[model samples]
Target: MSPAKSRHLNPKKLIRSKWTSASPRNKEKHFIVTNIIQPESKDLPIDLIELEAVYSGRSFALSWRELTNTQDWLQGWR
Candidate 1:
């Protein structure tokens, strides 16, 4: 068997054991702290101001251009 397939055979446990150990209030505080620390993506308006494409000989060719300041352009791939 392949290494990747063998890894999937292992049983997985998803219990939050620490939650039972901690008090109810402590769990809430933990969640709040974790949420604050978690990185969030800011939804910024993008202006698709200009789009230019060239097609020599094809049935259908589609190209797109948008105005965005994001470091990585391909948002859908992510």
Candidate 2:
């Protein structure tokens, strides 16, 4: 099978964005971007983001870049 196309994402506008997992676990299929982790040094770029499960209220941190991987995440609720 061919690889999934990566989704376009603007890091600056990631906050409050919604997403859906392509393969969900724990019934946490829908999620929202709740936080953007800031770098300790002002010169550094954003790297991590916090995602909260809409169904379970659970949250976790992951690299923002991971969202670009279409195989794992979709841009909006699906």
Candidate 3:
């Protein structure tokens, strides 16, 4: 199976645990996932979130469909 298909079916759970300083040469924030959820878990996560420091010249954004009337986490940013 393709990675995209697997991701759509059930996103692999990942434990995001640290942040690195962004530099002039590197505009994107680098994230390290510490661990991954087992295959037998329940509903997959809606989206994987990443925290970016705007002061460091990096901004991360997320947009999602209304899957089952879930609450929005980015309301304050809008």
The model with the greatest lDDT is 2
Q: Distance from true position, residue 68, model 3, in Å?
A: 24
**Candidate 1 wrong stretches, greater than 4 Å:** 1-46, 56-78
Give the C-alpha lDDT of model 1.
Answer: 0.18
lDDT of 1 by residue, 31-75 (tens): 110111112444532211211111211111111121121231222
- At residue 71, candidate 3 shows an lDDT of 32
Counted clashes in each candidate structure: 0, 0, 0
For each candidate, the alpha-carbon lDDT, in order, equals 0.18, 0.93, 0.33
Residue-level error in angstroms, candidate 3, position 25: 7.6
Q: Which residues of candidate 2, in runs, are more than 4 Å off?
A: none
Top-scoring candidate (TM-score): 2
lDDT tens digits by residue: candidate 3, 1-78: 332111122223333433343222355434333334333445654453434443354545322221111231211122
* Shift in Å, residue 75, candidate 2: 0.9
TM-score of each: 0.13, 0.93, 0.22
Please list the Cα RMSD from the true structure of every candidate, rounded to 1 decimal place.
Answer: 24.0, 0.9, 12.5
Tens digits of per-residue lDDT, candidate 2, 1-78, equal 998788777777999999999999999999999999898998999999999999999999989999999999998899
Clashing pairs in 3: none
